[model samples]
Target: GGIITQTPKFLIGQEGQKLTLKCQQNFNHDTMYWYRQDSGKGLRLIYYSITENDLQKGDLSEGYDASREKKSSFSLTVTSAQKNEMAVFLCASSIMGFNYAEQFFGPGTRLTVL
Candidate 1:
């Protein structure tokens, strides 16, 4: 069995501030992803990395930057938080070589911008 961990389960930030989140996994998976879920909305991809030192921007990546520094860790930075915005950021991972593979998710980090 393996485990994935995300730091700071809750975050409160001011508008226009840059907030960062971190994720780590021990599953040895090659693909990692970050997604945002707004209230009553489905998950939207923010960024994904196929391997170490590689990065891919997703549909909702416009306001974020992501990094995969090593095989077991990925991190995301919110470029600028918006006022009154609230969302949950989720980190996921899956085995390599299959695009449609099932992903395992973290507990999620909830963000609230005041």
Candidate 2:
């Protein structure tokens, strides 16, 4: 059992700017994931990594990039932010099993692009 935290509780970005959000976990989980949650939509997976430095693109990965340089941390970058775009980015970690993995999530980082 461990805790997860996201840096910069709120993020403000400019149009076309590359904005990055960071997440760290003390859980030492083998798998990490990044997801985006819009105002009224369910969370959409952005990226995931099964091991350090291994990246797997997710449903919403076209406009984003992600990295897991260390087992304790994962980061997501918005390649080109869109004006007036707003979303919540969530970070999660889990010790994956063959079929079931219980994920623990961070508080979340809210993003606003002006």
Best prediction by lDDT: 1
CA lDDT, every model vs. true structure = 0.93, 0.92
Minimal lDDT window, size 10, model 2? 95-104
lDDT at 29, model 1: 96
Candidate 1 has its poorest 10 consecutive residues by lDDT at: 96-105
Predicted candidate 1 versus true structure: per-residue lDDT over 35-113, tens digit per residue: 9998888999999999999999899999899989999999999989999988999999999838689899999999999
| Candidate 1: pairs in clash | none
TM-score of 2: 0.96
| Global lDDT of model 1 | 0.93
The number of clashing residue pairs in model 2 is 0
Candidate 1, residue 53: Cα displacement in angstroms equals 0.7
TM-score for each predicted model, relative to the true structure: 0.96, 0.96
lDDT of 1 at 64: 94
The number of clashing residue pairs in each candidate reads: 0, 0
